[model samples]
Target: MDAPVRFDTKVALVVRADLAVWQKLNVAAFLATGIAAAAPDALGEAYVDGAGRRYGRMLGQPMLIFTADRDQLRAVRDAALERGLTLVPYVAAMFTTGHDAANRAAFQAEDPDTPDLVGLALRGPKKAVDKTVKGLALHG
Candidate 1:
């Protein structure tokens, strides 16, 4: 059988560190979902060890975290778009009260005004990802 394909790239989830703990967690989860949807191969597979314990490895894929404010987030979004890079953006409605309500809000909230970007997940060539996120500091 042929081996499973693996991506030789880097994944980064840049988020606003100033958000509340819950918001941060929500952003991270949404961002990861974006990466998984875009690059499933990068996630690798689940395997069992000799002791019969199962382990889930992130495939050793590099996932760098960075912090940015509202303006910085917008800049990153623009940069990603300009570079033709895939961007998974988390919007304001994602922090809404309920799942159904959030989805409704998000659908209604989509407009030309460009909803605020709370978080972003970008994946591509290592050099490309690095360049796109240049000048951004690592999440503290």
Candidate 2:
């Protein structure tokens, strides 16, 4: 037999019961739990080829899915859907570009502004020269 107490501390105790259980979780586990806890209001936006294709911003339990090509995009989307997650396609380039706006913009225009050779390789070096003759015209 148990007696019901009319006290505000009852609710606090009930909520805090799981506190110790959660405190032992690692950083990755904590982050995953936090995401799951906040999934009710999280959003998933897709950027396709530098354009916003689909805006599933209101969807709950949102997750970002990105790829470099159409085939890879299809595979990623299917895998996500199979895992009970929403499928949204976002271009990897655009997502990465968000980190460095200036360099991305310059690269998009075929102009190499960043000192990163890899970035130049990814975006290509065609835009740096107006014409093939001018581009091929070597400077000594």
Candidate 3:
């Protein structure tokens, strides 16, 4: 077998720890899309099965998911920004939003200084990402 490939960059998703199971799942899925949009290069090529059926492409690199409390989530967001990493955030208001426009409006209504973040994702160099998520535990 060949040696495992190593990625220089890391992808991480962090969700507020107190959310319900369904909310966590929703947040994770939304956060992942943001990472995909920001890092198109990370997407692997589409796949075809034996019968020539095509499948959607996925991220070539692994993404770590973590759980954090409100304060911890804010800190992680701050750290990601401080390190100049690509960041995407999902605010609590987004849960009530029915569409993209409403979501945008909800996000916009948030204070620029401190959004009421329910979850966030980051894409950056491995070390920086590590530091940003330090002390967070993997989602169970």
lDDT of each: 0.78, 0.26, 0.95
Q: For residues 1-140, what per-residue lDDT tens digits would candidate 1 score against the true structure?
A: 99874556778889986899888878888788778878777666788899999987563475778998888887888888878777888877667646756765784676635667779889877778788899999987
Off by over 4 Å in 1: 1-7, 55-59, 100-108
Ranked by lDDT from best down, the candidates are 3, 1, 2
Worst 10 residues of 2 by lDDT: 8-17
TM-score of every prediction relative to native: 0.81, 0.20, 0.97
In candidate 3, stretches whose alpha carbon ends up further than 4 angstroms from where it belongs are: none
Candidate 3 — number of clashing residue pairs?
Answer: 0
Candidate topping TM-score: 3
**lDDT of model 2 at position 35:** 41
lDDT of 2: 0.26
Put down candidate 3 lDDT per residue, 17-132, tens digits, no spaces: 99999999999999999999999999999999999999999999999999999889889988898999999999999999899899999999999878999999999999999999
- Which is the winner by lDDT between candidate 1 and candidate 2? 1
User: Which scores better on TM-score, 1 or 2?
Assistant: 1
